[model samples]
Target: MSYTSFREPEASPPPSRPGLLRRLARDRRSMAASVAAVVIVVAAAVVYLADAATKPEVSNAANALVDTPPSAAQAEALGASPSASVSASVTPSAAATASAATAPKIPRTGWVPVDNTAWKAQVSAYNALKVDPVPAGVGNLPEFRADCQYSHSLPDDPIVAPGLPGASHMHSFVGNKAVDANTVAEDLTKFTATSCKPVQDHSAYWVPTLYDNATGKPVETTGFRVYYRSHMSNSTGQMPMPNGLRMITGDAKKKKPTPRGATGQFYCAFYGPGDLDGIARSTNGNWPICGGDATLHFMMQFPDCWDGKHLDSPNHKDHVAYGAGNTCPRSHPVKIPAITFDIRYGAKGTPAGYYLSSDKEGKSASSMHGDAFVMWDVDTMNKRTKNCVLQRRTCDNYGYQK
Candidate 1:
């Protein structure tokens, strides 16, 4: 009875439980796997951040390549100078490309086709005309005059420093009243206001302003005479000057001493008997002192023959040449009217001397220069060339022979 009581219903053995050591081992393995997964996730995130940081650098390098200037070889292949810097990013429009392709190539020497179609047609018509025989015993001078008065002053030069206002030194302008740095060939025709006689002459003339060294004040011109003449003795076959012709005379960069006998030294001009080389010399020996009723005067002359191709050249002088004896050079076959500027100023010389606006050193007056931008009515130009220049007669402003 005691044994039976002790056995109290043997409960079924508790469901087979996993050993504690085995469970612990399994949990440790799971922990190790989770740790490895976290490490992998961190490594992936770091890689993503590093790759993102490098992408901008790569894009910047690509853009730099696109903006690089053309190489020397590439420029040569494109018919451009190696020194000419060009942007690779700028793509020319189709219309511009076509225009460039059709444009005439500038020649290294000799005549080339005129680039402007309208001008080319005019040239052809003029070349086809029959040249009338020059009258016997005609005077050697074949000239027409355009007497101009000073119009205004500005620090602009359309030929040398176009479109850049105040880039140049102060200049005294005559003839065309609306001339500025932004003026072009068409603008000369459009702005018809002029300070010259025969209002038809809408040309522009400019020279560096003369300044008094002692007062630092500008001495403007009182008389500006622009003469259009033939340089050749035989004026046959001379053509009318082309519209939009530009010319420059005297070297503005010349800084040499202009002593008493200098070739282009400023001189005295008066009606009565007075010394043309000034009454006294300046301290620097470059300026001349005028006597009573005398004034300062300068003369600038331009070439008379053109290349018949370019309206202008890189140097602004390569397109024209002075005739030798009675013949023009082969390269400049087209004879044109020569331009002469007689500029008179009201100031007399002082001991301090005078200086041109182009002269920065105030040492001498050797930097004197002049520029001419010629524009005229086509019919008027033609008539003057035929009646005065071609016929070897001196004509006044009204195109009438004097």
Candidate 2:
């Protein structure tokens, strides 16, 4: 009866179930552990991002970016032409840049050589021309003359000391009026204003200024006759004087004493009852004093042969040479018109005499020198050389053989 009444001992009270507060405490501890794990993961991610931002990017050999020029399509997408993109990306090598910097620059203006194809063609054409035969009794002088007056005075010599103003002795210039220390071949060709009679002759001529010893004044030339002639008897294959041909006659540095009959001495020019060496002698025994209506005159002859290579040379005279007998020297094979300067002064000469600007110490006429810078119309020069020189006839200022 007692066993029946019992409720199976209440199933042992469900094994003493836990309280609500204890359960809550255990759940809070588990939640705190999970939150700490999440915080640690977030901190590790933040540190990785910060290190990536601060560190410099280094190139790995296998993954290095190539700086190649953009393709045409890529350049177009970037709003640039392909050529511009390529030029912008490329750079000159250091060696090329250094070579350009160290290379000698060719001068634009100066005594440049005449070695162009056009000039060579001109030489060939000149050589191929037919020489006209000389008629009988044509005076036998293959020559022409340029009558020039005094142009201006300057202490400048374009041939001797180019671009250096006042570097030369005082020179009385004739022919081309625009001649100066800075004068070039182009200048003479362009500036056609000349003191010479033939307007086509744009050449320049200069000589040292003659100074009177007593008055200490410069004596300018009254007349300057430039004779272009050939000294050879057989005047065949004479070429026209090249434009920009420059040469000097006589030695300005010759300080030797020039007596009355000395070579290259200045003498008198008279007609009747007078000597070519003048009547009296100067104090230096160089200059001559005329007795009659004679005045001081000097003749300077330049070489007739050219080297046909340079427009000018170092000494200015080595490029030219006087022809021997009837033929030019092998070194200077081109037969050009020889230039002769017949300069006349108004003074009759005195005992004190005169001194050339080039000869201050020597006070002699032996130092007298003349410089010629030739320029002319190509047609005129050719015509004169053909008609007057090759034909062996004397031509006047108009280049006509009468």
Per-model TM values vs. the true structure: 0.69, 0.70
- For model 1, the superposed segments whose C-alpha errors exceed 4 Å read 1-116, 124-140
CA lDDT of every candidate: 0.71, 0.73
lDDT of 1 by residue, 1-402 (tens): 001111223333334655765766586677766654554444444332322211111112211221222233222222221121122343444433443454322112111123355565565666565544545554546888889999999999888776568999999999999998878778899999999987889999999998898888888998899989987677755777778777788888999888887888999998988898898999999999999989889998999876565566556676677877675555565678899998888888899988888885856878898999889887677777777888778777876543
Q: Give Cα distance to truth, residue 109, candidate 1, Å.
A: 18
- What is residue 352's positional error in candidate 2, in angstroms? 0.9
Residue-wise lDDT of candidate 2 within 141-223, one digit each (tens)? 78988999999999998888875689999999999999888787888888989999889899999999999998889999999
lDDT comparing candidate 2 with the true structure: 0.73
Clashes of each: 0, 0
Query: Could you tell me how far off, in angstroms, the CA of residue 213 lies in candidate 1 after the best superposition?
Result: 0.8
- Candidate topping lDDT: 2
